[model samples]
Target chain A: MSMIKTDKLIYEYAKLDDEGNVIGTNRAIDAVDLEVEPGQFVAILGHNGSGKSTLAKQLNAILTPTEGTVWVAGRNTKEPENIWDVRQSAGMVFQNPDNQIIGTVVEEDVGFGPENLGVPTDEIWTRVEESLKKVGMIEYRHHSPNKLSGGQKQRVAIAGVIAMRPQCIVLDEPTAMLDPNGRKEVLRTVEELRKKEKVTVILITHYMEEVVGADRVIVMDKGSIVMEGSPKRIFSRVEELKKYRLDVPQATLLAYELQKKGVKLPDGILSTEELVEALCQLN
Target chain B: MSIKLENINYVYSEGTAYRKQALKDVSIEIPHGQFVGIIGHTGSGKSTLIQHLNGLIKATDGVYYFNGENVYADGYNMKSLRNQVGLVFQYPEHQLFEIDVLSDVCFGPKNQGLSKEECEKRAREALEAVGFPGKFYSQSPFDLSGGQKRRVAIAGVLAMRPKVLVLDEPTAGLDPAGRDEILDQIAKLHKESGMTVILVSHSMEDIAKYVDRIIVMNQGSKLFDGTPKEVFSHYKELENVGLAAPQVTYIMHALKERGFRVDTSVTTIDEAVEEIAKVL
Candidate 1:
């Protein structure tokens, strides 16, 4: 059931000298292994320079693994011949919407991917329309991408990938540039995508709130898979996650603090209501 | 530092084949010393609308009024308006191109035709205001961490000494600490400077927890304008418009759906905890 898999994933950026010579290689992702099952929402957490994004890129073959292997939909990303196939099966969304969006209009931008994929004219429009509707952007289909909000443009960017109908989607800090409302929209759309399209989602983010609803949570530190579990399990270790420079959800953190201060309670509290119900049961 | 948008409409590439009507008949008033949060689903015209208040974009129809007079009036001093209404753009780090942190932060004040001595003082103060240490002034912004580079960008805007400060998605892309650091600094700046503050954000949690008032937009129209509670109460409407308030509210809503008598009025964790204490 694993749709995307990684083995000993390693990536290095050239540490150049003053004269532009490669003095050494700074290891971005180091000896990382990951697997994502079909129809699962996976979140990766790491601090800056921790190589989370590097791994997201590797899944789509945007950057080949320096010393590892990645398979998307059972197609090896490192295989030169399978580059296009791997990419078509695993779409990528990045940090900034302004940079990724290309079309002048929303629908046209969504259609660009299918059109480039050599889909027939009639079918390209069909895919574009459905993708736009999926993201709840059909109303602004004729609007300029430039005129769209950061969140809307990003949805269009997602629509562009959905138009390709990829089996798996890798989003690198997709909500990093959105406002609160926009982030909600994008998250809802991603959740809907999993249910409606059943695409495997690999979401790399640092926001603890965003990960609460995810199916599985993977924590990366110094370019390695440091922690892997469901959100409840990952969030249960409050001090441990905080040591890695990650924040647990506020309610979870509060529950942990209260536990430390002599309250007999459970380990992980995912939402406010849970914490409220637990504390309310005081004997 | 009040900003009044009077029937503002922004059209990109006016009279061209690729023209876009970004903002349409949008009229809203933000008063002095008010903490307002602007929220919208993508393409809802919040970005376009905020840009007009600072004269970043000329309104195609209607006008933007700062204080009392129209900003886009004939021969209006746009530069002065800019100096008074500092706008920190989203992805602000992309705009930092100076060689050193000091020079970059000084860019805004220097453009205001201030003396080098005055500009330097403001830059130093602004950097401090944004919580950047003294050591960062000499270092290149590129050498700093992503969070620090973002701080430098905000400092650059702060150096303008604007009475009305506008931030576009200031906490986007930052981790929880980075987000809290930036949002707290903004709150402090508003208190210390007594400036009118407009925060544009996507996190309903952040908006609900911080700003006094909330403005929601959808497809270039203002869906509703009121307190966060008032706006969040329209959960169905917001969901229909591709928006939601906070996760806590959603959870409470879900609890209500399941026959739990938990108060759905709470928009945050602390409030939710207090309410659930009463219910359970």
Candidate 2:
């Protein structure tokens, strides 16, 4: 069964006049459809104004869609009674680690989510340990979050969501702020979580390289799913992605250019090794 | 022109209930005009170490010397050191409050007590330095895109005309293109401005492409200090410290695991291609 399903979702920001008067509305999302199977790792990609973030917000019910419905684990998010349920069902990790962190210490911060759900003290600690270990942050559990690097902080945040034991987790540009090392740390942690915990993963990011590892890639532009395919399939179409103002993986772009210039390399070369292997095959 | 930290230790809220040891006997030196990247798992004292560089946080047990002069020594005047070593923090947009881009960029220079004309000139120059158009001076800083807001924030620091510029996660909220643009601008600024630049980032590819040196932090201790190639060459060590090399490096290493003999230390795609071309 699909873990997440969205149908014809629409959202609009309210346009206002200078005097707090009501003006028209500006559409952010048009008709959109999306689905994610259980244990799938999905990546959402787009430019800054492309409504990708808006769609993510909808999944968590941070913003209710203007039209259509979203179902998380067969529960409709649009239903008023299930807002908290939806939030718990689909946890979100935002781009900025500083803003999302609430507690002073790493383990305490991870415990916050489960604590809010009224989980008992013993269970919270257990969840905290398991989650921290999952992200490989157990060693720093007693340390304060402020002293952590951006990537470490992000891992702690992800552990916090995992502690909730949610069925799905949605990250909105989670690694956007981290350095090269931090970005790798957080992405590796996320990938590991999907493998070990069997939790559904939704990662919103602009880095094409990151999407290469995802099970599926969803493209958003003007609040719609413009492209949906495996990373290889999506990257294979270099021209279509470029028209959406999105950059493919660097190697993919280079390979595409080489192919255009009449190299016999195969399409959708997402990594340097793949490109090299393909070129080695030529002649 | 290098900045050195000798046995630096810092504890937040020294006497309060919230007292926390952020750094512990840390010692490292950033050579002049060198592009150094600082990486660590969270709570590894990376932020605290960088703050001490410009005297934003005075070390409790060590010394900070800018060009071998004690910046925290008696009568040395930390205010001047701050001007010489400017910091652009993560989400630097929080520092922006002015009505327009020009006034905001001028804040640092104006606070330095430069003449009004000098402040204006520096603001314009700094804006251009970050690649913002001259016409953007009149636009409200809040009116620009997230990437533009970030540039304006960096420009604010640049207006100070510091010899050393430090950024803490400068590309946090930017899109991929914006990420590329900002990193490229920092590289260009380093080359064109010849300023000492220290970047704190989480993307290995970013540091691999721009930084001249890499500094690894874990548990609030300086673990590795060397060039990108040298630092990333210890990918296993980095992973043990809760880090990984760039994707290209990872792929290269994976190929090596599968019995291929290509070098894995190549940092950039262009270089990776060149290395692979020679072997393949």
Which candidate wins on DockQ?
A: 1
- Ten-residue segment with the worst summed lDDT in candidate 1 chain A? A274-283
Clashes of 1: 9
**Pairs clashing within candidate 1:** A149-B43, A152-B42, A176-B173, A179-B201, A179-B202, A180-B201, A180-B202, A180-B203, A181-B202
For candidate 1, the per-residue lDDT at A17 reads 60
Measured over the true interface residues after superposition, the C-alpha RMSD of each candidate is 3.9, 3.8
TM-score of chain A of each: 0.96, 0.97
Residue A201 in model 2: lDDT: 93
Task: Kindly list the per-residue Cα lDDT of model 1 for residues B1-280, writing each as its tens digit.
Answer: 6788888777888889878888878889988998999988767888898888778888889978888888877898988887898898888999999889999998998888999999999999999999999976998888787788999999999998989888998877776677888889889988888898899987888898888899998878788999989999998898787777677787677667666787787787678666654554
Worst 10 residues of 1 chain B by lDDT: B271-280
Predict model 2's lDDT versus the native: 0.85
Interface RMSD for candidate number 1?
Answer: 3.9
- List the global CA lDDT of all models: 0.85, 0.85
What docking tier does model 2 reach? acceptable
Angstrom error at residue A282, model 1? 7.2
Q: Residue B196's C-alpha lDDT in candidate 1?
A: 88
Model 2 has a clash total of 15
